[model samples]
Target chain A: MRAWESNIRKVVPYVPGEQPKGDRLIKLNTNENPYPPAPGVAEALKHMDIDRFRKYPDPTASDLVHALAEYYGVGDDQVFVGVGSDDVIAMSFLTFFNSEKPVLFPDVSYSFYKVWADLFAIPYETPALDANFCIHPEDYYRENGGVIFPNPNAPTGLLLSLEAVEDMIRHNQDVVVIVDEAYIDFGGKSALELIKKYENLLVVQTFSKSRSMAGMRIGFAIGHPDLIKALNDVKYSYNSYTMNMPSLILGTETVKDDVYFKETVQKIIDTREWSKTRLTELGFTFPDSMSNFIFASHNRVSAKELFEALKKQQIYVRYFDQPRLSNYLRISIGTREEMEALFAFLEKYLAQ
Target chain B: MRAWESNIRKVVPYVPGEQPKGDRLIKLNTNENPYPPAPGVAEALKHMDIDRFRKYPDPTASDLVHALAEYYGVGDDQVFVGVGSDDVIAMSFLTFFNSEKPVLFPDVSYSFYKVWADLFAIPYETPALDANFCIHPEDYYRENGGVIFPNPNAPTGLLLSLEAVEDMIRHNQDVVVIVDEAYIDFGGKSALELIKKYENLLVVQTFSKSRSMAGMRIGFAIGHPDLIKALNDVKYSYNSYTMNMPSLILGTETVKDDVYFKETVQKIIDTREWSKTRLTELGFTFPDSMSNFIFASHNRVSAKELFEALKKQQIYVRYFDQPRLSNYLRISIGTREEMEALFAFLEKYLAQ
Candidate 1:
């Protein structure tokens, strides 16, 4: 029975990682920053005018967009904000990936990419990453409708060079090329500086990772004027108030306080390096991750066994049950104390 | 030259009401609640833990959904929430309006309806309202892919009876029928109670009006489990974190405080009655309004001239430059003091 459902909308929804309740767990499933947001976030939330809820927020989110433009040294028209990177990327797909040729992406990129393609009825193909889980520049040189891939790609956390990104943009000059930089602040360089040269390039980023505001749900895109116009066109038609009051006000503060942002991101990178050494001692191997999470597989014990064992002790880490990632776990870097607890538990289990 | 644009996404975007800054105006253009949200809203903002922002919000919005479900006397799965009514309605078009047959709606209704149809490439037809600016049940008796219209329909605050709504559903049981009740709390009856008897009925309401949380951006749909399931499937496929922390927490508190909600709604309704009497004495005529706004036309003055004159005095009311509604102004019921000022201005202009 159709039951009032559209034939076009019978989609298998993208499953977000578990957000467990009890505070007892050392959660490392989703790649969230361990530190709190900038000091201004608390001040902003505290000083928020609750009375203003009677009126609507500015539909265009001009203040935040201007702040982003200023911070990135770009024109005001270059910036577009949304609920999250998920929202930005989803809108980008709707606006750009509509030609007859199939858009090309990595087979093992963020799972939501394929979901958006299927939902929008856009044809797509996934060129698999190499054996080391690295994106090959040559793979994206072919003709396509559009191209999108996460920089410092998720789970594996491998960063392709800025030079390689330039090659992909230059080759796909006829199509829109999106550089999803959701995890850029932790280590990898940003593609924002290249937006001036590549009119077809769109760089997408989120406050959920480095700025520690995943609960706030703020994300943005930096691109050329014409491409951004197309995005704004579709977004306005879809929903005018995509960015709410809290996001618009608080997100501006996040961009304004760049000193605190640098400190938080540097601290996370420090913790990640320390965890790398600890995991090696425990007989787990992973790539030199540039993002907030590390994708590792145990050399001795199966990843499934380790994932289950960690959950038993209330130390949660993500385990993909698919073919390629079935043997690995994507573990978000936490505070030093939380990482210690994870190592202590693994030490016991490995000894057994 | 299309300039790297998608042929499918060349949309003429919907233009929302102007949100003017620098508070020199008495704004009644959009049907936003004139009062602040519940008292608990301010306290909630003050006490929100900033540290929790590092983590993502609950994707399902369980607490808020549960509160709405409990309030409406429906199962949890029977409720669906989104960023705003615009978001909910847009998703409904994408999720439910599938068949090749054109969906039917009011020829003079909320302008966003036609915009959504154009954006999604869904075929739609606007059946003409009767000369009295009231919906005729017989107009919707024919076949359609789906149907949607606001209760106490916008720009003309006249309502069709519950029986009329049921008639549309009864006639179109094969498709979904949406009764958008954005201003129902002001005077009109809710169709939420009819959900139990009619699986095809989806009642959409918003916190932006009676609840006074437009800045918070919360709206919901009440329907049978299957219809609600269809909404969720598309929502999850689009963006998981549509509702953020502030919206979820504040919206939940709004539902819990029934006393405040009743008081605010009653206050608005009382003001609406008072405004009706004053306008009658001034030679202005209108229908018996069942919503917060009054659709009025003066016997002597041109709507265009009045609209321009009000703008000069920093008093704003909605004026559509379209057929049938071109002669009328949609004035939202403001506080007694604000309404008194509007009356003073009009009285002076008429004496001239």
Candidate 2:
């Protein structure tokens, strides 16, 4: 590796879901919201005083942090914002994990956690998820530097209960336990309330999925004041103005408009339930997911073949090449119309 | 430190210039453009289709890169964009500098370079600038892993000639030499053209200074394809889609509008020249600047005293605590009206 840093060469980078171009496809990947953000968000962006953008944005993202704190019923000191949840996670790794002690995470959860651990040269332990793809709380009680997992874990879409999250945090009092609630708005209780009780709990969320602002790139974490301070220190040391002005303004407005969030999330949940029922009827076996996506596989059709077949029909879905979950396809929940179109394409492709 | 990474504890972060609040003051710090971005930038941002923000931004920022490539007269493959030029520099440290070989840069250049080097754990040697506060290219030709310096460099607005840059690159063929042209548009030659000849040359520029999009946070580098590929690999391993949607569109439009860029740079340069002459006539000693700011001090006034005096007059200027530079104040080139007000206040203060 030409004498590069040992960590840089050894890093296994995180691969985000494919974002293919062209408007001619029924795209059901990356778990992005099918609908646009709230009307208030667009209006906020439209009315942004571009003249003020010449000034550097507030390093604290003060207004957005205040808005999130009020919404989550936590004090402002409990919150921290970044470019996105990915940035928040990166900051967390730098803050908590070290070369000496290994951080712990679920084996089949968000892939980025492992990548970040490697990039930071932090030793890590990936405790296997049980056969049904559930995270056991007791496994995390062991000695480790920190713990992180997507609540409604990616790929599997299986969620750990808030009680389980509390158990892990309570037992692992000396280490930071981060709950990445990127998809919690779709389902699952947020561990935000646990911040008051557990100094080690850091709940991370993003505007990308349920808020439908992936292109905007804003995310935040809620934790005890000490934990938040550690992250802020790392962020300031790295990049001061991590969140841009437009994202900050739009993110603040998105949090303020609770009505839009509730309505949009309800619609996605409805569509997800309907899609799961239809897939079951078609003899597809998958986890009963809490997130805005489903993990499924058909008995006769291989996931790889089905993925290719759908691609030929101009319908896109995500298929993993990793072991344990290689046979399943992770399908994002789209709008009712897009889901109907996907079913129609599947019917034709299956018959062929 | 409770099992935290050793490197995390050792990081002494970079401090960005102050972003003062309230609109009552004549803000001249932070080297921000006194003017808003081009009219087209505001228009592009105002009419942004929020729905487009739901999908991920172009991971490679191809459209922005292409537009920048065209403006800089380089191939798209020769360009790399990041969250800011700081991000680009950070990525460069990861890609080009090896831990075994020490990196080299000016001791008085961008402070963030040292921070990046430290964060990456890359050993670096800060070659001292001459007593005149000028960067001699020959100094960087010494054996090192890589070298970088801001042209029209920060704190002191001195610049190096393109010939000197070419000489340095010619001599240091084994190391990557980056010319950070952050303020090049003010009145300095960009080394972008040399990328075709010197494969080791990397030219980094930002939309923050001339284009007035600091709030949007976009910066880019023009380099050989291999160097660009290395940056991309590091970026992908870090956080893909570093630039958000509004920045991509606005930055692309701003880069293409060369007329606006030229006019803005001319206005700032003219203001800087006018301010320098006025300061000199008032018995202020300062370097002849080639950038959008003036660095000067009066024999009668301590830099800190002058800073506080100006603050009392609702005018803000940057003052650093670093050795040799502490006696001077760095004042950003504001609009003609703002500079006149500053001059009026200084005249009254100096007379007293």
Candidate 3:
């Protein structure tokens, strides 16, 4: 290594899914919403004062926070916003997971968890998930620096009951417990309801998946004011202005149009149900997904072959080459027409 | 303290300039650009397809990065983008300043540098700037973990000669040296040209002051490909999608309008020269500022009294109550008309 290289923080970053530029391909790899954001988001951008670009945005992000608080029926102090859910969770890890004891999560949770832990030098332990890709509440009951896990966990798309989630939180009341609810709006109930009861519990949600504003990069956390304050302290110290002008204005606009928000979510849920039945008919088996995506393994064809075949046809889906996931493919629910196209290709490819 | 609070990364966050919402105020506190961003930025947003909000923006920020690369005449691998210059510098601290040896910077510099050092648990020492608020080249010749300082230092708005900046970088070849050129476009030359000769030198700049996009949240770093790569690794590990779609697209449009960019920078420079004559005539002393703002102290009147007096009239300027800065007020150079309004008030107040 060069002399200067000796002190460099060497890290293997988490590789996000490919965002292929071509519009012709069906993009289901990143679990993005197939629908557009609220019409107000478009209208807000159109009418925005471009002259304001000369001034700095509000570091407190009060406008977006207030809108979120009103929608969720929480106090304004309970809300914290960031560029995206990744930014929120990363900030939480830095702010809360500083103890000597290992932070805890599922072995097969969102891959970014381990990456954050490593980046911050926060010791972490991952207890193995059970055979059915379900988290065991007892596993997180032991000593830890903190706790964080995705609701309706990624790739597996399996969710634990609310009681189990509460059990984990109750056992680890001495440390912060973050329930990342990126997929919660898809089907599962959010832990936001329990924020009043547990001061250490933080519920994180994003506009990326259910709200169809991933490209806009809006995410937020709701918790006791103390926890939110701690996160904001770290956030302000790190970067005072993570949320830009368009995001703050447009995100507030998205929150105002709850009717449109629910409609798009219901459409995705309906498509997910229909896709699940079709996948079963094609000899695929997987966990009952509570997320926008389905993780499936066919009894016949190897997942690698199917992944390559799908890619060759300009269709994109997520496939992890790691243990316990290599044989499965994670497919995000697209529109009915898009799902039909996926199914048509699968039926022909599997028969061959 | 609460049990969970014991492990919280407690910190005193950097307080950014107050972004008071009232449009009636003659704002000149933060040193933001006085003019709006390139006209093409508004045009791009008006014509943008809002349907793309459903997908994640390019994590690589390719279009913006490529635009910046072309403008700077560097390879794409040599450019790095982030939410703002603060984010870029914070990421650099976490990436390049990891050795046991303490990093070095000016004693009185951008306050956020110390906050980041404390936040990341990186050892650092602030060598005092000369009594003139100027960086001494010899002070940075000693062994260190890393080195960083704003080119035209904040609050003081005094700039170091390019030779002095290069001497510091040459002496610290074994460690990374960052030249924060946030106000470079105002008058000073950038250390960016030295990136090819010294691989350890990373030059960071922001569009906030020069290109007029503070509300949009865009900043970039140009350095050797290796340094850029290291910064990117940490950035991705922190948040893959730091640049949202609007920023990516609009920032690119700003870069494409070189004529507008130069015109605005020249306008601010011209305004600064004109304001200096007026301030001197009003019996104030200040460093020979080469930045968009003038940091000045009155010959008789107290800065605190002047700050409050201005605030009462809805004219905002910055006053730091800390050591050496208590008597000084940093007034950003506004439009000719706005500066005349400010002079009108200062003349009446100082005479009284």
lDDT of 1 by residue, A197-216 (tens): 98899999999999899999
User: Second chain TM-score per prediction?
Assistant: 0.98, 0.97, 0.99
Across B155-224, the per-residue lDDT of candidate 1 in tens digits comes to: 7888888888888888988889999999888878788889999888999999989999999889999999
Which candidate ranks first by DockQ, i.e. highest? 3
Q: Which candidate comes out best when scored by lDDT?
A: 3
When summed lDDT is taken over every stretch of 10 residues in candidate 3 chain B, the lowest stretch is B10-19
What CAPRI grade goes to candidate 1?
medium
- Tens-place lDDT per residue, model 3, A1-352, is 7899999997996677788879789988999999998998888888999999899999999999999999999999999999999999999999999999999999998999999998999999999999999899999889999999999898799987888899999999999999999999988988888888999999999999999999999999999999999999999899999999999999999999989999999999999999999999999998999999999999999889999999998899998999999999999999998999999999998888
- What local lDDT does model 3 show for residue B278? 97
Where does candidate 3 clash, by residue pair? none
Model 2 misplaced regions, further than 4 Å = A1-16, B1-10
> Chain A TM-scores, one per candidate?
0.98, 0.96, 0.99
Off by over 4 Å in 1: A2-8, B6-8
Query: Once model 2 is optimally superposed onto the true structure by TM-score, how far is the C-alpha of residue A10 displaced, in angstroms?
Result: 6.1
Span of 10 residues, lowest total lDDT, candidate 3 chain A: A13-22
Ranking the candidates on DockQ from highest down gives 3, 1, 2
Highest-scoring model, TM-score: 3
Question: Model 2 lDDT vs. the true structure?
Answer: 0.84
